[model samples]
Target: MAARSVLVAGGGIAGTAAALGLHKAGYDVTVVEAHPDTAEDIGAFLTLASNGMRALAELDATDAVTAVGFPLTVLRLLDDRGTEMAHGPLGAADDPALRYRCLLRGELNAALQAEAVRRGILLRHGARLTSVTDAPDGVTAHFADGTTLTAALLVGADGLNSTVRRTAVAPRTQPRYAGQHVYYGYTDGHTHAATDGPPTPPDTRAITMVRGSGAAFGYAVSPAGRTYWFARVAGDPLPVGGPGHRTARALLPLLRKDPTPAAGIVEACAGPVMVTNATEMPLGTPWHTGRVLLIGDAAHAASPATGQGASMALEDAVVLAKALRDSPDPHTAFARYEHHRRPRVEHNITVSGALSRGTRTTPADRGDDDTLTAQLAWDTPLPAAPGEHA
Candidate 1:
């Protein structure tokens, strides 16, 4: 097959990274993102495990991300009564192969976009792909603005509620509500320790999960100096309001009643807060069609319970780009991509969920009982297996 031009939809972390990865492979690439510009601030901080950083490193943005973020020393786990359960060092701490980093989602996205554009890739912000049609020769994208563009392959990096996935994947199932509703936000805090005073981001965290008929609280110091936090109530009683602005005043009391004291710290957070309705689509087979393919949440929407949503997405980008570069036929590349990604992603979600089921009702371990264990403790490194072509 002749070398093909590629179109990537979405400007978020995965989309921007895909644009850069494909461009490095010498494909004429264009990225269409819904965000007006890449400069917008992402209020929330995300933990980029050592594995996700490895994938980003391939796109040459790992250092850029680290510039804005930092490594985590420890992941401290606790029971609801706030007693330590498990504490392990990250990176060389667990396995010599293990590594973990944290970052602001927006900053990472910005870095990838800059690198993508630096490499001569076209990145169009405020562009939303409405639909796509593919043939043996190329793929054509129809935009919401009624504009059309052609490319050799179209990548659906749009996201969990991805329109690209909906149209291409067919009768796409509606995302299921995770049993818990989450309240989350970020603020500056050098001390990851529960105690006050000057603090350093810890190799270990003061984290807990109290078994209760009620909500669960989670706290951690992200790569950035901010203390990132979240809480989950049994049903969907989320505090109404947006972040960095006005939040439902009623939310504090509800969160205050949380079993873990971490919930109180989150409650004390007087800055910005968002009561989010977290949802997920179970793993699906056949991650692609012909010239159009899926990456990240657009392909495998993992339950955040696994804390591998970003990791899985990053891995998808790495594997997909590698497969495309090697396979002469786009179809073959798509199949191979699915084979490599689908099973692993499905397993990650399943195992994380099993741990979460224990969290919902409270467990033998206070932190393990209702807290999101999978999200905090373990990290999976990026799969750097040489592509069949490489």
Candidate 2:
């Protein structure tokens, strides 16, 4: 039989990574992105945890990603008074390839997209998906520019505001605020310094998390003496439209109250501070209907408290491809994929939501590390779904 043809919606981290995985799984994958180009949300930065790195390795795109970002091997915790509370190795810190990595969201997206294109995957930019038609035979994607493409399956890897999820899977579902406003910014230590404040710590590969009285703050200094930091403060959601042009100055007061370097870093920020309301999808939202299925943020978006959004998306790509490659048909593949994914991602959403809402003090122990390691291993066969023969 001929290789199955799959159409993936959205060209961000999740979508592009899905293309890479599907192509590697011996499928004819075509990626359609609404954006005119690869550049997007240049201000935001994120860390891909160890599990995400393992997923990238399974897709054979680790080098493509590792080349752009800096590694983070240690995690440090500090109290509101700038006192060190605890410190330890980050995820898979012993392995260079599997260690945590930090980089601009746009850079990571560009790297994945470029790698996909280089591997002969058909990636069409500016192909905005206006709607989707999932017939019994196949699924057809309708573009805003009056173009249409039919494929055996459609994967929605679009971000939080995914058109595919809203139009096709769950029209009534909506993302709810996770009870905090997140602010992130960058400051160059070489040029910017706190005039009278306490001296900021030297640049290390460690990500420092501050337990403030009013907000949760974290920062990591790059190898080049640049600091990337974020603060999550309890607040009402931003205006319904979006995070307007908010500056870092608004956070100075809260940071200063904690006696930490967070305030100084914000004061010395080199450019505009970006802010967004932490949002997550409701549990039990439908992920698929017939030949169309949702993955990544479109299916399950958690708050930034866990820092697992990108990692979860990357994991989604690899597992979805594996399910399709191993299953007898699309229906089995979607079922297997959901069976394996829903529990883990939903746990993240619940934990992160609680943390954001101040209902939880610490993340629960994830006892599934070994199981996850096996699942992301490319050479390892995926486990059969419950009540199905292996």
Candidate 3:
């Protein structure tokens, strides 16, 4: 039989990862990205927990990713006064290989995209998917540029506001605001020890969490002497507002009130602060219809607080490819994919939601759930990709 051709939409992490996996599974794959430049370094750095790194290894992209990122293992929690509240090791603590990682979002995307291209996958930029028509044997994707491609399967790896998801898979599925707004600003020439007094810890890989009144700040110093910091505040989700600098200015007062290094970091960052509301998709949304399927944020977007968004997306791509390679049809493959993923995704939603709420409210106000949070962070097992070694 001739190799099956698959069309993957949105060339971000999930899309590129899916292309690689499908090609490895003996299927022809082409990726269409609406954005003209996939190389642009946009957005703040993100955390790729142990599970996500393992998934990248399955695609043979771990070496490339690790080359450009830092390995993180310890997370320190502190109060607004910079006093240590509690400190713990990330992951199982015993398994050193499962160390947490922090990397620039753009670098990770670039690495994944480069890996896809290196494997001879065709990637088309500036092609926005307008609609998708499904047939019993195949699916036809119509691009906004008056171009169309027919393939045996259509995979929506687009992010939260996915066009493929809105047009074909589940029109009614929407991203709901999680009642928190976030800001991330990167500083150049500014050290993490911006605050006066004792110098910050020598360890650069620790993720420091500082809790203020109804708000939280997190900063991780990169090996390059740059500090990646973020602030989460309770706010309205709609009518997105301001450039990064302006947003940073607006949130400065709150940070000034905070007695941690956050105030200094925010004050030192250059222009362009990323401001957006935290959001997540409702669980139980259908992930596929006919020959079309949704992966990543299209199917389930988790709050960034969970730190599992990227990991979940990477997992989705690998598992979906496995199901397609093993099952006889698209429906069965998508069903199997969802069956194996929904429980964990939903569980993360709850875990992340509670954590996010805790940031906006007091920990005591949020109730005692440290045990649940710890289990979700360290004990929950991510499913292994097809062909991944145990």
Candidate 4:
């Protein structure tokens, strides 16, 4: 019942994962990326939670994941002077069976991308989706390079500013700017950024939250043992956009205060620091069209604070591919995909928003602190494991 072919627009973690999943289901898949090329260094650290690991497991790439990433066993919260306020195990330290697998975004991306290539998935870089036409038989994607191809279904797995999203759906409005901004980058490890000072405090693989009265900073150690830091200040992305250096100059006025870990990390960024934007996709309505469907950031952009953006996207790929494998007709498959994924995706969007909005408090103090239940439902089971969900 799988579709004959699928076209996944965008080559990021979401799009490539979808392409690989669909291809493994016996459907011919092609992935089109707007980026001209790819590199080993993506320049950002990512926390996988338990949910992300289960997704990678489905691809049977956990070994590769283990090679590059680390396990998160505990979370520590500290104040400006390195005073511990809250500390807890990441549910894994207590039970070694529990897996809160965390890794670098680049490392995971490389694993997924390599698996996709090994499976004969057609990978294209520098191919921008210009338009999409869903016909009675199949969907066709028109690219900026004056080329076109047809497939049984099309997936708009593109991220924010997604061209696929704009052409296929109701064309959701520009993302509303989140009121705060951040500066994030990766370090070789937990090396102190304060002019070669002592190690930073409350450091762990668990996603660390350095909270304050009106603002907060959230960050953690990535899989590669390199530290990742983000300082969330009350502002928006700097207007000037060229490179990270220029943006940092403009944001200097906005990020003057050293609030806890934010102050420490900012001094340590050592490399180029860019202004970060906190924005949300209004939850694009009608996430589907004739033969086109949306997934990942194109359908809904999860706030980084919730840390479920990648998890939800991976789930979308699994659910959508399962629907296609179960239904005979592409339309029926598309319908089933929407029916099963709609509620879950919407709730996640809301949860991510609420988490970001309430960042100034500890997880227990936050009104919408349902991280425990949220984690279980979101994590997909590892196929190799006898019994596991997330």
Top TM-score model:
2
Rank list by TM-score: 2, 3, 4, 1
lDDT of 3 by residue, 1-390 (tens): 133889999898889989987887778999999888765446677888777766666666777787777777788887877678877776634544446778888888888888888999999899988999988878999988799999988899888898888889788878888878888877766545535446565467688888876467887777877778888887676474542334477778887775677787788887778877888888787888998898888888877776788887877777677777776477667776777778777777777766776643332111113432322231233343454332
Cα distance off (Å), candidate 3, residue 96: 7.0
TM-scores of the models, in the order given: 0.80, 0.96, 0.87, 0.81
Order of candidates by lDDT, top first?
A: 2, 3, 4, 1
Two-way lDDT contest, 2 vs 3, winner: 2
Clashing pairs in 3: 244-273
The root-mean-square deviation over C-alpha atoms between each candidate and the true structure, in angstroms, is 6.6, 2.0, 5.6, 5.9
True-structure lDDT of candidate 1? 0.62
Overall lDDT per candidate, in order of appearance: 0.62, 0.87, 0.75, 0.64
lDDT of 3 at 118: 90
Of 1 and 4, which scores higher on TM-score? 4
Q: Which residue segments of model 2 deviate by more than 4 Å?
A: 1-3, 190-201
Query: Distance (Å) between predicted and true CA of 19, model 3?
Result: 1.2
lDDT preference between candidates 1 and 4, better one: 4
Local accuracy of candidate 4 as per-residue lDDT tens digits, 1-390: 135888899887788888867776678898988777654236656666555556556655556666666677777675654455888876435533336656656677777777788888999888878888878778889988899988888889888777777876757555655555555665554544332246554355576666544446666775445667666656445564622432334433333343344454554455775555666777646678788888888877756666677777776776676666666466666766676666666676666566566643333222113442332232332122112112
Query: Which residue pairs in model 4 clash with each other?
Result: 193-268
Select the stronger candidate by TM-score from 2 and 4: 2
